[model samples]
Target: MDPVPLLQALIRCPSVTPADAGALSVLEAALQPLGFACTRLRFGPEGEEVENLFARRGTGSPHLCFAGHTDVVPPGDLASWTADPFAAEIRDGLVMGRGATDMKGGIAAWIAAIASLPRDLPGSLSLLITGDEEGPSVDGTVKVLSWMAENGQIPDVCVVGEPTSRAVLGDTIKIGRRGSLNAAITLHGVQGHAAYPQRADNPVHRLVRVLHRLTAQPLDSGSEWFEPSTLQVTSVDVGNPATNVIPGTARAKLNIRFNDLHSSTSLIALLRAALDAEEARYELDTVCSGESFLTSPGPFVDALVAATRAEAGVTPKLDTGGGTSDARFITRYCPVAELGAVGATMHKADESTPVEELRALARLYAGVIRRLTAG
Candidate 1:
């Protein structure tokens, strides 16, 4: 199968976060040509549209699911690119586009891989393509997973086609991702004249103590497969124009990238305790996305490593170090792992993937499928 043409066709669509831009249609067209029955599902609040696709082939046991997104991040500063970001230019043997390495290429590879399978393949195969992975992500995979559960379409294993390869095309396959929690805290203080410092409760001083306490100590020494937990103060915004007046409120936002050493609840508890020590009137809100998960290098991960060695001539490292992806949502349903092409330039001005590697990925994925269904 010609994977380049399919990759080019996918990259040509400017489906930047939360937009379809004909990306899914291109995929459906390819899958339908290969005998996969397609279904388009949309779920979100009234007046909001979130597009998703669930396609399946064969009718038997041992179902295998492939999941990914068609959305690309914004092509920053179009002038910096050698060619148009969505033109899908093939220059110097590299396929250049916004989503070239991050994903469009991976989806194309999987399509080609399944196309190469026998026409009467055993077991079942499916695809879960979402359009909201790079956005707030409320309406894409989460909704589709629910729909699958309600409709009794959950698969036995899931392979997320995220760009997990680091230095090479098959150097790493991620078994899990560290969870992310973002929070904003506001400490209330008294607005008093600067001349009378003793009368006013200074929120800045209180918040400084709180932040220092939070950051002074490390969250952990580090887990086996994960790095040490980290919490960074992203922003401390007072928005106060007058320096002479003590502000009524001091606000700050922190971004925490934590590992399996701590749970979201435990971190929240620590935050509350810190606030209690400060005795400051404060309020906080937290958003948690996927606590750390591990698949334990079981049969699913072993198959992936074997396929990479056979097809790509390299042994892949089982990793859990990266920002969160849709794998977080898939982990709830079954054992899931992420393996794909080299992501040297995913969401940049001149994102690219070599043409040769794209074909190699197709072969690698085909081998994975064969190994999965051989038994």
Candidate 2:
């Protein structure tokens, strides 16, 4: 169960976002021979089908679930890649492809680690994998988690194999992540020729003022275990091609990465207040991807830190800085943390991981599994 071949197999699948592309089947073949009972879960509407897999070995207490996504983000501008994005090319001692680090490689490492464990050891072990982490994420881990809850498949603790290390493998363990909220605002006004400035109500002016109010102040001073929240204006568009006409509508999009101090509902209320003060007719839509969560330092985190120090020789730092991950969804069900390879290249052209690093990560994961399940 060398991770190299398994990672190569996974990377070869062009399972970008919602597409399965046989990625789960490849994982199933590998896990089945190792005594895992695998279940394929297909979720979402028919047109946007997403495939997920849940597999388990043993059926006792202290179930340790490994969660991740098999899908990779789209390989942008393939012509710029040194090799085929799905080739899993081994060059300069690195495995190169779309998902080499963003996650498929991490999944391979964990599976290989499981294969290394003694057959009779452990209370329970399971994998909750999905194909929608890189997309809208509506039909992936969230749905599988609901199914697990209904069927009593929830584990005692969970580890998400997202790329959390910033510089080297095991250097960081994400104890939590900030929540993400996306907002779109459209301001309605009257369109008029530039010569008739007094007749045209300028929605752009109003929209800019609203955006300024949102960004003018910090969301919060840094939280105890998390960084300060942030909001960025992603886009502001009038879509007016005519230089002489004032646009009738102005639209702006915003993305906020917030700490536990604020929930999406609270933030939405704050935004509404701002819009109300402007006295402008407008429409607003907000979508919350996840709420902020933290698994406070305790025995589970202690086990992971100890294992990482022993196996990778890094005193792993507990961090909460990063974009939202599936762990956000899992946090609702169980204490969860994130650990994996360095993510410096994830989602970029020529995304890759060194063979040596991949093997090392397998050993680290093995140590984590061994420590957490030890009697």
Candidate 3:
């Protein structure tokens, strides 16, 4: 029931992105003995299969599902670390690895908490874990939720263990998150010599004009429980070999993190109108990761706030400021919130969390499970 060793075992798997690397097997091995019925789910195209796990301890209402992902972003440079990223070494009272904080630790903590509790104490307890969270996410939580719906495994309320704390563990909880939309714009034109000013149609200039139009005004002011929407231009490429010749094609990519004041559809229309105003032939492709959503103050949220205060000795703030997560997908099925450890080192070179903090987080999660399932 000690979360540290289980977390150490999980970090040793090297389960980067879509690769299993024995991560779920480690989890299954731990859960099966604790009376959890584990179901392994493989979803997506033939070659890009994603591994997911749905483990439930009971079948009843008020199902308290703990959602998280074992897949982690790659450790960029091994030389930058004091120890191997996959070694799961404990250095100076810290667990060091790729997902030590952003969330293999969280998963291990929750499982340890569950193990400490009586098996017959709650209505139901479940876990919806996915392996595609750090990747494109085409075959992860979204598909798993759909299958859960068909198979009657939807929980009453869900909590995502997404490393939401800012300065201290359990100091902050994400009640919602901003929506994400990625756009790619490609403009085509005639390629010709620079000296032939009359023959060459410059696409770069047109693309710049379009970008200017998109960035000229603010999307909106800050919304209630959310920050102002933002549009950032990430890249612009021409791929022209020579300076004298005008490139035949120009492409630009941008991302929008929007609040609840707007949806992806409305924003896409706004983008299309801007392109139409330029009267240029271009292709606009957009991918909507998720729509902004908020879980209002209620019994479920109240239970989470109360649990954090009782267990972590802090009145957690209900925040809605972060990038997208699988929580966005869960919001469609039920009210969901996020909580976990301090994330100062997540995705960094020497990612880690304090050993004491990890143990305390397990206790805090135990409190949350008790309060949520006490009905």
Q: Estimate, for each residue in 1-375, the C-alpha lDDT of model 1 and write its tens digit.
A: 879999999989999988898998999899998989999988787767888999998767678899999988999898899888999999999998989988989999999999887977678999999999999889999999999999889988889999999998899999888888888999898988888978888898899999999999998988988888899999998888997888889999998889888888999898888878888789998989778887778788899999999999999988988799998988888989999998879887799999999999999999998877654
Per lDDT, what order, best first?
A: 2, 3, 1
In candidate 3, what are the lDDT values of residues 1-375, reduced to their tens digit?
999999999999999998989999999999999999999999988987899999999887779999999999999878898889999999999999989998899999999999999988769999999999999887999999999999999999999999999998888999999999999999988899999958989999889998999999999999889989999999999998897999899999999999999999999998899888877789999999999999998999999999999999999999999788999999999999999999999999999989999999999999999999998
Over the stretch 1-375, how does candidate 2's per-residue lDDT look in tens digits?
A: 799999999999999888999999999999999999999998888877799999999999789999999999999997899899999999999999999998998999999999988987769999999999999889999999999999999999999999999898899999999999999999898899889989999888889899999999998998899999999999999999999999999999999999989999999998999899889899999999899999999999999999999999999999999888999999999999999999999999999999999999999999999998884
The deviation in Å at residue 8 for candidate 1 is: 0.9
Clashes of each: 0, 0, 0
Q: Give candidate 3's error at residue 359 in angstroms.
A: 0.7
lDDT for residue 176 in candidate 1, whole number 0-100: 83
Question: Can you tell me which runs of candidate 3 are displaced by over 4 Å?
Answer: none
- When summed lDDT is taken over every stretch of 10 residues in candidate 2, the lowest stretch is 115-124
Whole-model lDDT, model 2: 0.94
**RMSD (Å) per prediction:** 1.1, 1.5, 1.5
Q: How well does candidate 2 score on lDDT at residue 345?
A: 95
Best by TM-score: 1
Q: State the weakest 10-residue window (summed lDDT) of model 1.
A: 366-375
Listed in order, each prediction's TM-score against the native is 0.98, 0.96, 0.96
